[model samples]
Target: MVWVRLPVYFYKRNDTFYFSRSIPSDLQHRFNKRKIEVSLRTKSEAKAAKSAAALSDRLERYWDSLRMEMIYSRELGLKVLQDTKPCTTSEYSLSDALALYHRLKGGSKTKLFYDVSNRSIRYLEECLGHDNLTSIEKSDAGRFRDYLFARGMSSSSVKRVFSSVRAIINLAIREQGLVITNVFSGTFIPDDGAKQQRTPIPQDALKRVQMVCQTLDDEPRWLIALISDTGMRLSEACGLLTSDIHVDTVKPYIELIEHPWRRLKTASSSRQLPLVGASLWAAEKIIKEGNSFAFPKYCSEAKCNSNSASAALNKWLKPRVPAGCVIHSFRHSLRDRLRAIECPADIIDAIGGWTTEGVGHKYGDGHTLSVKYRWMEKIAPKVRELRSEETVT
Candidate 1:
């Protein structure tokens, strides 16, 4: 079979082929450079041709997007095409879209959630303040990823921040009849799976911290010990009310429900966590005080309750725990321990407020507190047992 030759653009320098394409004359002024050149970094013609083809396609799409922007946004030095709807009041400001998006979608979320959404938008404003929403391009999204990385954000974090950015843009497009494509819709962040931000605290460090926790007579310490066994989220524990504790029942558990003061992360996050080991002791102490809120210092109406607890807990745990372990790691540890003990997956998920895959939706009334209590106690991550295992290992 004979290979049919097609048009190819490549230059060879120092025994390596590089893809080269001259910018369209009409769009050259829009770009900083007159032409685009990408190193194929291959001496073989076959390899160079394949690499250059992909690069050329990307450059073509980018140039076409630029040409479309010029026709739609700029008035002079272009044909008055009937299809081009010139940008005027049709394009909204990024700042305005941010407010509109938050007001519509962020009403019930926690302060920290809103902060992340707002901060992501603010970072965009810092880079391209008051830029038009419809005028945003793929290049802008790429720059945003670089900006987050330059500020030392992890790939996971950068991906999360971009997700918020994309949500804001997409929400405006879908709900409010905004016209632009979400440039952030399919933006990629490299190496997002390289390092996980949260990991289970090592058994040795957990045992040591549990030992030190027993000695301190402070609210943060109580909070730490309370979550040590139950694997409660820092926010859920902080925002608990006196009414949420159920130590009097046949199987005592912490009933996490939303209140006037604090909202839960998800409907599933509102769960009954069985109190065992250190958690039982902590609950008794919390009951002894008889305050309306479990931890009054952090649960005030005026404060961002979850953030207040996070700051306090992280500050206290930073020195005590091993490197890379934070307050959230307790939840990770509990999940790992439950899995290690061979507990049923659904029960473990229900105990942690995680969504069950296909369990209890049809017939049963869901796992009862008594059933959950047994499983929770079975894998409570108690200092004595876990520490002994660690020592033997």
Candidate 2:
């Protein structure tokens, strides 16, 4: 197929300025015309450019809203005539479809997952002006992608939102048998394979945290201390129950499992991590406290507040740690520590609950909890003495 570069929505006829873009073929039936031509009727280049930009934006918004309503109406079994094509009549709105999707997609997923899905729909509604499934055009999807970037969402974040968009449309197609194409499928998604942005907490800065935790004698700080050693995700650490802590064993570790309050990230996240050093110490102290949770403030049987816990902890931790390092950097630091000691990739994966490479990793019974425990204990404690913390800064 031959492609041609199109300029930003500016055009002119006989010195009269206008904004125009070719409407997509699939969507042209809605307008009964191929091109979006809005006359500004100006002569000056600068004024014409400004007028065209505004008119172009208005026209795109109108088109998107029109398409959304058409899709939504079709999904509800309503026959909406888009040009000559007949669409079945249905009463499903974009919001209604998304709500059904969230309901159908339930089980073991966190509130945050639903939150993201809902947010994506809301963003589409905002930009496209509340239309139904038939209103969704390939052009609308492109605009939504650009809209997300305009809102300062990171590339990875944009991809995640668009993923929800795709899922919503696919679910609508299968369950409702809507004839709409998934415009979200073929959009440009930024590559995000580089290393994460969060920096690891340096060894020196870690001592400061250890000292602060020791002095605070608080459940929150104790949770921080525990995660620093175990390299558990903040949610995993914050959501621990007394039942999850098995200190009686020869190789003590916290049992990471899927709980309603705190869902495991994956099956690998369900493994038992050997708690050595400060984690062992904190686990011992936590059991002595006789509370249901290790950190009562961040965790309850009903829900885990890992995000809130991170926010609170990071607020205090930001100044203590180096720049670019947050409370979660403890997990990053442990991964680096494991790599530095030449720990095997599979073992590291097992320890961190990272998915292993290849189907071959699925065949074996996998490393025993004891084998994981052995590799975990190889790393030493982060704090040799509390005095080290006071010495720095």
Best by lDDT: 2
lDDT of 2 by residue, 1-393 (tens): 999874677766898766667876666665445765545546777877775655556556866766798789989999876447444422345776787788888555778888888888878765664334564567887888888888988888888898888888789888987766788898996764643688998876776677678777778878888888888999888888888999998888877887778878888888888888777878888999999877888888878888889889889888888899987799888888889889998988888889998999988778888987777777756345453446433
Backbone clashes in model 1, listed as residue pairs:
none
For candidate 1, the lDDT comes to 0.75
Question: For each candidate, what is the lDDT?
Answer: 0.75, 0.77
